[model samples]
Target: MTIAGSDSGGGAGIQADLKTFSALGCYGASVITALTAQNTRTVTMIEPASPAMIAAQMAAVFDDLDIRAVKLGMLGDARAIATVAEGLRGRDLPLVLDPVMVAKSGDTLLPDDAIATLRDLLLPRATLLTPNLPEAARLLDTTPATTEAQMAEQGAALRALGPRAVLMKGGHAAGPVCTDLLVTAAGITRLTAPRLPTRNTHGTGCTLSAAIAAGLARGLDLPEAVALAHGYLQRAIAAADGLRVGSGHGPVHHFHAVWPHV
Candidate 1:
């Protein structure tokens, strides 16, 4: 299940999550916490769902389907975060929490005050937290990371926030290679891939976390799931330019290697 916002562009948020789940052979379900009138270029407007509506959607899923894992994306505000936390409290499902704060087009996806609620109410319940450089920085109230060493430090700090592990994404890093750091109680490991040159990276974070959720649903361990998801994201970025969806930043091809590339 993916608890996220809706992207009318179908590039990121719940749209990307469902595509990723299907590509990875996992059945997908969703609870939309907000709705955005957005395209690949920009988010024109955002309207949050009522807490009651969000709860209803979650109950509609948990009450029926035997969901294996959950991927959380853009919760619009504090009430939405509280609603989801309350609905998911005490459930032991593997949760891939992608701290989605802003969009690629520089639009705010999550409201400011809700950050505190996410930290207090949602972080502890997460099995794994995936935050990019900026999101990690904002969550910790520090400067964003720009190097592998810095990312490792940030990953460790994020793990201390109560998630079993934290995956600090390095897409914002300046380099020929992008490195993602996974910090767990077990240890820190680096996953690197040559950077693909493309502006069509609109939905990468959402896709990667959703892929991880799909992998967990299929019974892979966290490390294995993350590794596979990383590989998938790389190919999706590589194939992104071929897709001419929008005028500005386009979306990565979630189905690029659906038959298996790595």
Candidate 2:
């Protein structure tokens, strides 16, 4: 299940997550914490769901579905974050938390104040916390890492904060190869892939996290899940140009494996 915001553009947030879950052969469920009036170009407006409604949706989903794992994204505000934290506190499932603070178009989705609330309440409970360079810097109150060493350092710092593990994404870093560090208490495993040239890279973060969650749901271990999800996103990004959904940074192809060549 994905606990997130809804993107009307059918790209990032809940839409991308659900698409990823389905494409990866998992039954998808959702609890919307907010709604965004957005397209690939930019986010124009955001309306957070009331705490009651958010809680209700979570309860309803947990009440019936035999959910195995969860992916969290775009919880709009402190209230929504707290509500989600409360709903997930006692659940014994793998939680893939994606710290979604900014959109591909450079719009801020999370406010400055709410970052504290999220770190305090949700960080400790996550099975895997995935944060891009900028989001990681924001969470740690430091500048974004420019090199792999710094990324490993930041990942260690974040792990010390309480999550079981952290996946430090290096998409923001400048290089021909994109490297993602999977940091655990023992050590860090660097996963690298060639950076594909494509402007349609929206929802890349959401899709990766959701794919990892789907792998976990299918009984794969952390390393296995991360590997599969990493490869999946690489292919999705490589195929992203086939889609002409929008004028700006468009979405990665979630159904790259299943859909006929575009």
Candidate 3:
């Protein structure tokens, strides 16, 4: 299940998660917690779905589907987060969480109260928590991470907050190589790739987390899943390097390999 807000632009949030899941050969499902009037350039408005309606959607999915894994995204407010958390209790499934605090256009997706509930309830239940440097700093209530060593340290600190593992993404940091650190109760693993110089990077966090959910549904171990998902996103970005969509940053081509007859 992809629990997220709907992006009318079809580039991020639920749209991106479902596309990534399907491209990775998994059946996709979703429960929208909110709807955004957004595009690559900006989020003009947000209308959060009521908590009751959100719960109903989740119940409908769970009652009918054999959900093996869950990819969680934008929960609009504290009530929505609490509702999702309450509904997910006692389910023995792999939960891949992308701490989606902000949109690519720099709009806040999660409210302050929701962030607290997420750290307390949802983070502990996550099989893997994926957070970019900025989100990690916000979660840990510390200064923004500026170095690889700080990334690793924050990864460890975030792991202590309850998730079984943490994927600390370094894409927002300045570097020749984008390093992603996966820290588990078992050990730490680092995966790096040359940063693709492209504007087609919208929905990257959603794509990565959804890819990890697809990997988990396909029965990969945590480290292996994370490593493969990182590679997948890197390739997608490179393949979309020259493609243009909106006037602002475009989205990574989900069907890059299959389309354009390259």
Candidate 4:
């Protein structure tokens, strides 16, 4: 299940999560925290769901269905973070938290006032926390990382923030290869793939975290899940052009290997 915002463009948020789950052979469910008016080019507007409504959606899901894992993304405000955290209270399920901050087009997704609430309330509940460079930086209240070593360092720091494992994405770093560092209670594991030259990278983060959550639902370990997600994302991005979506940063081809689109 994915607890996130709705992306009208079907390129990110809950749309991306559901697509990733389907591509990986997992049944998906969702509780939308907000609604977004967006395209591949930009996120034009975001309207957050009320706290009561957010709580209701989650209740509707938790009361039924055998949900194995949940992925979170684009929580719009403090109330949303609190409501979600409260709804999931006491459930011992795998929670994959994607600290969505800004859109690929540079639009803010999370309200500035909610950052602290996310850390204090939601961070502890995540089984795995996935954050790109800037999100990790904001969570740490520091500068964005620019190197692999720095990413590893930040990954460790983020792991300390309560997630059983933290995957720090190094896509923002300069290099031929994009490395994602996963820091866990045991240690850190680096998942690397050759960076593809593509403009269609819009929903990469949401897709990866959703894939990881699906892997968890499928009984993979944290490292194993992240590795599988890394491989999947690499293929999706490499085949993104096949989707033939919007003109800028189009959606990745989620089922590039299986159930290929005609």
lDDT of 2 at 212: 99
Model 3: weakest 10-residue lDDT segment is 253-262
lDDT of 1 at 1: 97
Q: What is the alpha-carbon lDDT for the whole of candidate 1?
A: 0.92
| Cα RMSD, each candidate | 2.0, 0.7, 1.1, 1.1
Superposed model 2: Cα runs more than 4 Å off: none
Per-residue C-alpha lDDT of model 4 across residues 63-181, encoded as one tens digit per residue = 99789999999999999999999999999999999999999999999877899999999898899999999999999999999987898898888878888888999988887888888
lDDT for each residue of candidate 1 in 1-262, tens digit (9 for 90 to 100)? 9999999999999999999999999999999998899998899999999999999999999999999999999998899999999999879899999999999999888767889999998998888999999999999989998878888898888887889999999889887888889999999988999988789999999999999999999999999999999988888888888787899999999888653442
State the weakest 10-residue window (summed lDDT) of model 1: 253-262
Best by TM-score: 2
Off by over 4 Å in 3: 260-262
Cα-based TM-score, every candidate: 0.97, 0.99, 0.97, 0.97
Model 3 per-residue lDDT tens digits across residues 45-123: 9999998999999999999999999999988888988999988988999999998999988988887767888899899
Better of 1 and 3 by lDDT: 1
Error of 4 at 146 (Å): 1.3
Q: What clash pairs does model 3 have?
A: none
Candidate 2 lDDT over 1-262, as tens digits, reads: 9999999999999999999999999999999989999999989999899999999999999999999999999999999999999998779999999999999989999999999999999999999999999999999999999999999999999998889999999999998999999999778999999988888889999999999999999999999999999999999998888888989999999998887588
User: For model 2, how big is the CA root-mean-square deviation?
Assistant: 0.7
The ten-residue window of minimal lDDT in model 2 covers 253-262
